[model samples]
Target chain A: MSRIVLRNLVKSYPGGDRRATDEISLEVADGEFVVLVGPSGCGKTTLLRMVAGLETPDSGSVHIGDTDVTSLSARDRRVSMVFQSYAIFPHMKVRQNIGFGLMMRKVPRPEIDRRVADAAAMLDLSDYLDRFPSQLSGGQRQRVAVARAIVVDAGVLLMDEPLSNLDALLRLQFRAELKRIVHQIGTTTLYVTHDQAEAMSLGDRVAVMRDGRVAQIGGPLEVYDSPADRFVGSFLGAPPMNFFPALVSDGPALSVGALSIPAPSSLARFAGRTVLVGVRAEKLAVSTDAADGFLPATVEVVEPTGASVLLTVRLGDHELKVQAPPTFDTRPEASVWLRADPSTMRFYDPETSLALTV
Target chain B: MRRFALQVFCVAISLFMAAPIYLITLAAFSSRESLNEFPLPLVPTDPSTETLSGFLSSTGVIAGGVNSLMVGLNTVVLALLIGLPAGYAVARYAFRGRQPYQLFLLLTRALPIVVLSVPLARIFLTTGLYDTTYAVTLLHTALALPTTVLITAAVFVAVSPEQEEAAQIFGASPVQAFVRIVMPQALPGIAAAAVFTFVMSWNEVLGAAILTLNQRTLPAQVLSTLSFSPLAYRFAGGFALVVPALLFIAIMRKYLLNMWGTTLK
Candidate 1:
């Protein structure tokens, strides 16, 4: 139960100009779970490795609680890591794997046994204590990895895509289980994953990363609702946020193809300029009726996903995806009216791809 | 039809390899007179232990056998002690000249041991190590080290670095991690390497024959006495030399399979 902080971390591989992790700084509160989420190669895993002391940053300091641990080896840093492959010692049985750290530190036999039993019980691995790692299924091996980390009682826990190897259903099940276990243990944890859904569901605060930089860091809803840039805005949502090139006119209305909608007053100064407008699929309302402010469109495709139907509508030359109730099914080539809530609309600078205040 | 043909081919190959060893074993157990018979009787009418007893009773042959076992064990121990860490370093770390170093190890195999043996004997004499089992063991280690390093490197490369990192993260030092985690997984392959080293040292003749006089290994002693010894003695000595090599393979067969099978994930 300690805060972990990283300061201005930069790492670059040999013969490469681009830094793997560029000048990134973040802080995790005691018992808080912060997830670094991004696409592969965004350096989220590298950043987590730096915190774990598995990697050394070109220039950075890592602090666990009040002590600087940048120069410390992984063993001296008192941090436990759960790797993507689980990395359970295939030769050791479940009990030995969980009790390894304590044995390494020369803990008393009874104490190690007690702690290992406790962790095994918590992870529902008591029955498999005598079985080797190869005998366990993927999910069970992952639990043994967690139990190994938990029994150490390290101040910080680092996990790198721990659920990426499991099937979708198992990932979902273990995602909730991992959150529950971490919450119960109350260890400050830094988790990394490329899945935005996993990041949102597991993290107390999610840090969205792009190109070795922290694009945005906030609570899940805050990040989803108010992404700091186009990358973050587009990367966080499924059926991702749609962007349309629009012209801001004198009346502060945005014109896209043949349709025009009134813009928020904050964009009045950018009149007559071209800007990118982003709206999430769920934020757009589709109707069969032609309302006054609704833009007319022709439906190109309808996808029903049990809870909701995703409609791909062609608005002039551009297509927009609208999330509609599953009950609201319509054939392709049908005419529909689409409207976006003014408050939920995001405007971005076309050149920089940065979200503009609206 | 295709599967049956393939099985037949494999059986043919097995028999082809086994024929020479089977013939030698039969000659070792038969009377010397039967061995000299026209067709060379495939089956001995009266199996006699006379040749084996005569071979075992010879003082020079007994000393050679003991020397060979000692040299084999010593060479294996020394080669593993020096090669395992070097192999682990090459497999686990990135350093300057790693490729060149491995290439150098491979290149050593191209230089025949005979070319180095005379010079090695001269140096051994100057260093007061000549005509001793230790001199032969040192030369054998040098001969076996290249293969030992390469095999052990391939073995260690199959072990994941993440397993070691997991141990380090769990509060074990790098050395402790290697000892407690990496070494256990690598044992089977190391055993295979040791077996190879032992059999190699046991059967090597040119270097041992040139390097040692009174303390010659079994193969060296057998080669030096080949022209003078009776034919029954030759067959008995060949069978005796092949026995230990076969036993080493039998002991290490499981580990050899494991060594090849453990490809890192």
Candidate 2:
């Protein structure tokens, strides 16, 4: 099936309190592109390394295409890795870099040339094939790295933050190109990145990681709209999700200090108990009228970003970021009402931080 | 203003290093009669090849020079053959005792040559390699190895470990990855180490003197008789010794400066 299965993996560095990767298990179906996204040191890269056989787990097994590959070395496992630094064999020309794997596998000379040419053509690197990495631009060098990875047609491709090294504009451009190529080629890929936005746009399914464990694994929007915990909600959004504590009251409402609002019915059983409320900036709409579920807030700052205006609003003692349409003219210190849909807001147990399913 | 001052500082440093070499060359070429004058003329006065020719034609001079060249070249080969892999191990692997092992390699350099030479000479005498280039070659290799290993290891460390990992991921075995990925990129460092080893072996006198008698290297030949020889002959010997080392550096200057290629792209 060419599927990748990582079973109960655990790895720890010397003298570290927490494992780099806890008993983590994951699967990547054939032709699927799964991204492991997290904050730095969350073990996403380590887990990907374990799958590629660059790292051996303390206890676990890796299986690829129905064969146990835990004991196999990376060379024998037939997986290609694109390193974050591009690692483009700086000494070699672009043509040789793309053909290196086939050469090592003892492919015939003409066949290596043909495959390298094909890869170069696919990556739009035909003109630069004779140039060394030093002669190419940063974005072009990364294309060579990707070309090198895909030329071998390895069943699985492991990329460790391949786009993180590029500048913002180049990164955005490469992101779309990479997704188009990966989907067209249908190679199973396990990509690791600290940037959550890249994870959202590229992966068929995204696995959010925290403290060496998978926090949540689902389709990007599914995880974004309904996070498994406070960490995932705060991590995946731009400007991030706003978090504040609220008390569930028997009035079938939530109370944050003096302000009271209707609560999602799922929290009715937990009345008088504290819950952490999470809301994305885009989810909170600014209402002109005192409509249902509208809370009084004072606009603290207005930041116009062309397409939308980002407003920092103070509701009681809490500061919440609200994304408003650019046409909405609101200045600092202006009193306004912000409305949030009860179903769109996520609630978690205050101490445990686990989401309360509604 | 700052750039001009920095340029003057750099020029001053270069001149300070080059002055002795200039004086040595002038003294070696001048006739003995001109050298006898107080505060001798500094600008190639009475230019002659008499003293240098005399030194070159002395007993065992040509053979000793040839022997020094062979020993220097052999030492370069032997040290690199043994040291490169040891250096690669230190650079790539994180096994137990890795730090201590590198420190231990450096510590071996602290042992005095006087202490090592006697036992080494005795062993060579028993092994029938005494008074031969091989005995001197082996001794020089020992002296050159620590520098070779440490410098190459530093260079290997500069090479992104990701490149080697990328090679292995692409299908090269560990050894193959080092050959195909690490070695090509490590050439400039290897060249630098070679330059240092060649210069050290060509100039080293104490070990060569103690270890070999009839079959002496150029440095040992100069040391044995230069005390009784005239001042002009001594200058000639110094000039001769400096030329080859200078030539080796000049030949290797290109690789030494082109080291930034190994860094990540």
Candidate 3:
């Protein structure tokens, strides 16, 4: 039931060479699911570990509700974490592992039993209570790890890539199950992962990180549609947004490769500056003739997915991917025209990779 | 043709290793009059029970064996008590001077023991620890410590830190997490360390010879009495040495694979 806040937290290892977390500041509202997403080695996991008190921050403070727990040991933090490997005690039975936390606090034997049984039933681990972790399958071990955490009933839960070890099908299944469990408990949760889809589907709000800094923080769709910068746009989408190097023009059109694409009226001020155009694959329509916002492209390859066909086209030196319906026919070396609606195309400052207006 | 020769060469070397031990056992089982004959009797005409019974009946031989057992068990317990915590700290923590601590352990094993023997003898005499079974046990701890630390540290390293952290998050304190979560996983390693330490202490001759006189350990007793004592006593003592080492190796066979694997790494 506590809201957690981290202010200007910094964690650097000895020799000052590796900064595991650098100036990270975040807040999680009570009962909210806040996901921290980034590439590997991007410090998202480091930030979460600091919050759990597994790592000490070199600077700034971590506040759980009104208490500043910056210098507290992990045992004193009253926080639970689910590790990527699950880390269930291989020797102990599921019930003993689940009740370990209670036993440590010296809770009465009967009380520990009651709570452990309750947690097992909640996690659907009741049937496997007597089994050792080695005896269980990967998915069962994951549930036992969750059950161990739930038995503690900590106010906040920190999950570090908890589903990363599961197979794709299991990951999806557990992602939904985890959401339901977290929602049912209504505990404040901070989950860290490198997977964009995991962040999008599970997080109530997502914080996209790059180079140990949060690039953008917003609802999944908000960050996907209206990225704070070009990095966020490129990182969030699958098949990635296509980039075309273009020069700003005085009229309603800009020359890109060998074709002109419609420029929004707002770009009239920057006539000579170089700009990059972002066209999402699904937004680009392939046809025979040039249309209002069309650019001609020479098809390099047509890759078929069951649902959609992606046409990789050569536009001067740059390659652009155009998504078309599965029925669309275009062979290699074929000349095809692709168009994006003017409102859907994103613009970026080529020099800085920062998003530009219109 | 070359591979067949190499295999035969290895088998011949093994037999060379085994021949003297086999000859000694056969000679000890023979009677004193039969043993007097060199190059051995193909089958002793007068193999008798007198020599085996006489060796077993000797007070020094029996006392030395008992003392060796005590010293070995004591060394194992003492080494593990100190080594487990030191190993865990060295493996898991990143406090200042950690590299220096590791270097110090490596230095302990690197130096020749002969150089330390006289100085250690002087120190033990001043401390009133000379000529006692406990003194030999204490001396064996120094010999066992470095191996214990290295082996146990490797064991702890293999037990992931993330698991301990996960235990802490589940509400166990650092100490509790180590006891409940970490210890169970590293038990096989600790057992292996104990067995190694016991065998090292049991096999030691130099330290035991320098430390004790009346309560001499088995190897020290055997070495001192080797030329003077009857062949039967020497053979029985040798058998004792080989027997325990073989037993320990058998008991700790599983960890040998891991120990060698880790050593290779």
| Number of the top TM-score candidate | 1
Candidate 3, which CAPRI tier? medium
What would you estimate as the lDDT of candidate 3? Answer: 0.84
For candidate 3, lDDT tens digit of each residue in B144-191?
998899889888887888888887876677788888888888899889
Question: Candidate 2: lDDT of A48?
Answer: 92
Model 1 per-residue lDDT tens digits across residues A1-358: 8999889999998877799999999999999999999999999999999999899999988999999999999999989989999999999999999999999889999999999999999999999999999999999999999999999999999999999999999999999999999999999999999999999999999999998999999999999988888899889988878888899987789898867887888889999899998899999998998998898999999999999999999887778889998899588999999899888899899999998877
Taking the tens digit of each residue's C-alpha lDDT, what string does model 2 give over A1-358? 2789988899998878999999999999999999999999999999999888889999989998888999999998878889999998989999999999999889999999999999999889999989999999999999999999998999998899999989999999999999999998899999999999999999999999998899999999998888899999989988789888999998679887777888878788888888899999999989656766678899999999998999999988889999999899879998889877787789988889999876
Query: Where does model 2 sit among the CAPRI classes?
Result: high
The residue-level lDDT of candidate 1 at A50 comes to: 91
Q: Is the docking of candidate 1 incorrect, acceptable, medium or high quality?
A: high
1 against 3, candidate with superior DockQ: 1
lDDT score, candidate 2, position B213: 94
Model 3: how far residue B15 lies from native, Å: 3.9
How far off is residue A302 in model 1, in Å?
A: 1.8
Q: What is the TM-score of each candidate against the true structure?
A: 0.96, 0.92, 0.91
User: At residue A318, what lDDT does model 2 achieve?
Assistant: 89
lDDT of 1 by residue, B110-171 (tens): 99999999999999999999999999999999989998988888888887899999999888
Task: List clash counts for every candidate, in order.
Answer: 0, 0, 0
